[model samples]
Target: MLGLNKTDSKFLLIVILLTLFTPFLMQPFAADSGLDQFNGGYPDLMQKVAIFGIFAVGFNILFGLTGYLSFGHAAFLGMGSYAAVWMFKLLTMNVIPAILLSMIVSGLLAVIIGYISLRRSGIYFSILTLAFAQMCYKMAYSVLTPITNGETGLQLSLSDPRILDGATESTSLPVTNIFGLAMNSSYKLEALNRVFTFNVGFYFCAVIAIIAFYIAIRLFRSPFGMMLRAVKSNQTRMNYMGLNTKPYTLAAFVISGMYAGLAGGLLAAMDPLAGADRMLWTASGEVVIMTILGGAGTLMGPVLGAGVIKYLENIFSKINESVLHSWFHWLPDGLEEVVVWVFARFTGEGWHLTLGLTFMLVVTFLPGGLVEGIKRLKKLTKRGGKPKDKLDAPDPEHTPTPSKHVV
Candidate 1:
């Protein structure tokens, strides 16, 4: 760890507090209110939050550090998912090989794509990546049937041959296991007079998410990370300094692609299916949204953003007529019908519109994302903290003082 004084200590304390408190902040959404008409539980959604957190973290390395916006990153993610599913089909359901194969395949794909895409920079680079991704999607949906399984999505079936010896000839995809420790999809819980059940997969994802966070933190502090930051701040200057920035940028791209691959592999581990939808442009855009929404260039911000978006996608869209009836029927006959009519439009297909509006508002008001907004609110209201001890304060010893107190 970098040596730090009292100011840095306070900043670290705040971060620790936020991390410890975030689950509590998110606890209300996790509960089975009438809102949880479907599969609404902290454990289940937390898995999604973690997996996509891996995804957005990967994207941040490229877009955040290298300042290279990629529109094809999801293609790598899809390839990884497909690879992971195929591993499950042909080998053991243990996630180790699945995850490794997924990462390797995605890295190889990134090498090819990044080589071509890196030829151009700025908007042209982004367009090149986009075009490549669209090509991948098209091939998956059409000519790549043997590999990708096309439209209906690639599914794990026992009919497929397994070359791996000692592997189970499974009718169902092998249950998630390590060595011999089986990971089931169901866990029991009792709360008040109610009973609850959830999946072990959720906890697996949570553990992985913490690992992902630790990796991102290490990357943010490494010298390589600082060089990547320099590239973002001034590419021409870095070039003039005789640094071959291309290799660094390409490495970042591949690394990020692999992170996306890990995320996709995790998804496949949970579901044992791969879909062309994983390669969609919207999927790529989701990472960008996640990074910016959570706070671009800030550790843990993208995870927060991914959780917010996914929570909305799943829970925010489940309000149907029955859900409406259960809610406002107690009001009165006339008011209930009218209220349902109005609210129903905002659910189902209308969820995207609602999200779009939320995106617009967030971007317009908090361009630095929710993290920045929270920072501002803290500064404005929390007068208890000293300004000199603020997290973003410049290092005092490093700062040029008029006095010759070099010691």
Candidate 2:
């Protein structure tokens, strides 16, 4: 886990804040002014943020706990998504079945995969899994075209027979009316013509994110988690101590795969579409990036890393000089021009460049990642907070000691 330095503590606090109040934070009137630009609401993006957070959290369970880098975790995620979509087509539109089926399918897949891959460790295991994932991907894209819908992706077809709880074929549920709140509304400041959208999809994601965070926290504190960490630090040592590291490692792998599946299911449940592209090797790498960027071993780091990545993707890419011009209308033209240009360079098509640079800088300077950087900053601040004073300070014996006698 990222060292429990003050900065890391703040990182935990930030995750808690974001996940807990995500709905309000996404609203226009909330503390963050960036919300006003969205007229349709941020719920759609929020759903994605939550799903990815779930994905990263699950990945951390493997790499963070056992230090095993399979590099094919996305296979489970993709499989889960397909399973979820199938569930939607066959059963009711309710997410419970989709999520459950996703986990079960992923669990089975992981069992077979881990059994084979775990025979070897390190790069060999990673390559073995990668080969397997690629094999699966090709099958889904071609031979299994009928099942995967050939690359156009799977969708909810009313034509399909939902044999289980038929949820009125005519009515596909609206984007999660969780508490029945109208999620598609927008708040407008008429005079300024500013609008803040409230997307229903975002709330659905936020709630799920909160639940995922809680689960991660519990995992970090559990005895199983301790054993997993031991396996990572030194598997031989654990084995020498009579602990069967194999069982622990295998369990962690399966658990992590299940997590990836859950994330995938959520993605499909939020929007009834499952694509084979999600199983690509690049997608697996993305999860690794998320885990590392946030601080691999820390519970909250993965979520933070995921949010940061998604934010850059959705919020950062959408940014341009013109958007900046609108945002900085309150500033003078020359100053606005400079600010807009500088800010725009960090976004748009080259957003990946900015993320890569930021990631590199953090890794180089902090090594421990963003969580570590915060810790260093907090230590410095704490040191600075103390008022000037020398140790012993002469004990005040040489002066001012006579003042207390009168009182």
Candidate 3:
């Protein structure tokens, strides 16, 4: 199905089902229930989930496959956003052109940066990427003020030419759309006095994210992907075997940049604004965190990590003292105060602390991230009552396989 093998097809199916039902899955709390504070079914947060998922997935393709960590990837993402907004300003509010242009511009910028940065390896490469990203941010914020609009950020204005779509008669800016379907349009469902919103923009972003995931899967299973993995395992060995690893690494880097660009375009399509902060080193680091937190080198880890971190930022950050107190009200007065005092440090303004601790735990105890932990748990459950046989298991060192351009 969809040109996917059984495992890939199954994975894709799961993603599709989960995305389609996100509104319900993310908001299980009943209407008017105090616990609704935890519900993340709103369109704004859901759109962010899909956007960041695409960014992390693309980052995984390069970092996961080639083991090349580029700290300036957010530069491409910001470049994409700039290109998308330009398209909207000059051509039309239709998102198809904006998206395509964003990807192309980002890909071009990646080629330039990757070609120069690939000359170095290890920490030097990381530093070089970081420097480039910082430069882009600085320039976008100051030196390139004419194009970036300085600190105010790039925003759609009523004065844009919009040659293809023409200017609106009203002074208000036009909303982004596909044909006549507005990106912000939503269908509201009311049942049992609860309101559920199905947003067109979120669905569009979700569809693109799924397509990106599918492409990542195909890349992971292809011969080129095998070569990239070989490069990761040992580029020196690959060089000794007469393979030019730089070109392959550069190709992967550019592809990943395009993915980031597409994500940036989607963000603009949904919000119609671009900011220099999007190009910041911290933003790039966040994608890195999402990739590693989920599980580096795994297919679905990045997406999972993106969702997890975004949820933390959106949901956990909203908790306040009153809400925390309400939860522990049933406890004795003294005990309740103690509980709230201790737990309060991990919610609201302290959400970042909670995120840091969770990340530390994942790295220290579950190095393979949540997905690998789940697999190990399943394996343990399956082996219930079975005797251990260490010697019968396949030896990692002696495993054999056919290869082309091997490391």
Candidate 4:
């Protein structure tokens, strides 16, 4: 189905089901429940999960397949955001043009960056990309202030000429929309003592994310993907075999960058703003962490990693000292204080500490990331059942004879 084998088709179906039910799944806690604060069904965070999922998936295409780590993808992401915002400002509030422009602009930038960066391999390549990203970030903050709006960031203004959208008499800034459907429009469902929000923007992003995942799966199984794997396994060997790996690598890099751009455009579509912070080195590092934590080179790993990180950022970071005290109030005063102090360092403003610890553990124990951990657990479970009877096992007498090798 959809050019995918049975396993991949089933996987894609699972992803679609999960995405379709995201609003319900994310809002597992009822509104009146104590765990309600942990629910991440809000449109904003859901949009982010879908957006960054696209970002991490794209990064995985390059790094996971080609083993070329880029530390500058955030530059493309920012560029996409800037382009989308400009599209909104100069063209229309419609998201189609904004998304299209974002991908094109980012793809062009990726071509130039990839051409230069692909000249080197490994750490040198990573550093070159990082330098380019930092350069772009500085340019946006300084010389390109006219276009980027400097440190204040680029945002929609009332006076701008939205050529395609036509002039409006409204005093407020126009909201981003698809035709007449506002991106922020949402419907709330109240049932079973729970409230679930279905947002237009999140579904839009989710659809795009699903498409991206499908593309990634197809690419992973294609001959081109095989060539990429060859490059990662040994570029020198491929080159010695009369293959020019540069074009393939460059293509992968650009595709990956375009994916980042699409994610950036989605962000702007959700909220019409672009900032230099999006292009920061740390922002680039975050995607790297997401990809690695989810398992590089695996189809669903990046998305899983993105969801986990975003969930931690939104839900776990909300755990404050007061919240901790409330949860631990039953304990002795001294012990509660001690517990809060220890727990505080891993939540709230220190959520990164938790992330850091998780990344360290995953890299140390499950080097293949969360996907590997899951796979191992599955294997363990399968082995945990009652031992197979000797008669139930494959019989050597009935097995086919081994083919003799001619020497």
lDDT of 1 at 340: 87
Q: Global CA lDDT of candidate 4, please? A: 0.95
Worst 10 residues of 2 by lDDT: 174-183
Full ranking by TM-score: 4, 3, 1, 2
- Model 4: which residue pairs collide? none
Mark the 10 consecutive residues where model 1 has the least summed lDDT. Answer: 21-30
Residue pairs clashing in model 2 are 7-374, 41-197, 41-198, 43-202
TM-scores of the models, in the order given? 0.84, 0.79, 0.93, 0.94
Predicted model with the maximum lDDT: 4
lDDT of 1 by residue, 62-137 (tens): 8888889998889988999999988877877787788889999999999999989998899999999999999999
- The models' CA-based lDDT, in order, is 0.79, 0.77, 0.92, 0.95
Give the best candidate by TM-score.
Answer: 4
Q: Give the higher-TM-score candidate: 1 or 2.
A: 1
Writing each residue's lDDT as its tens digit, candidate 2 over 266-371 gives: 8887777898898999999889888888888888778778878887787667776677787889988789888878777787776888999888887788777777
Model 3 per-residue lDDT tens digits across residues 239-283: 999999999999999999999999999999999999999999999
All candidates: CA RMSD in angstroms? 5.6, 8.2, 5.5, 4.0
Q: What is the overall TM-score of model 2 with all chains considered together?
A: 0.79
Worst 10 residues of 4 by lDDT: 383-392
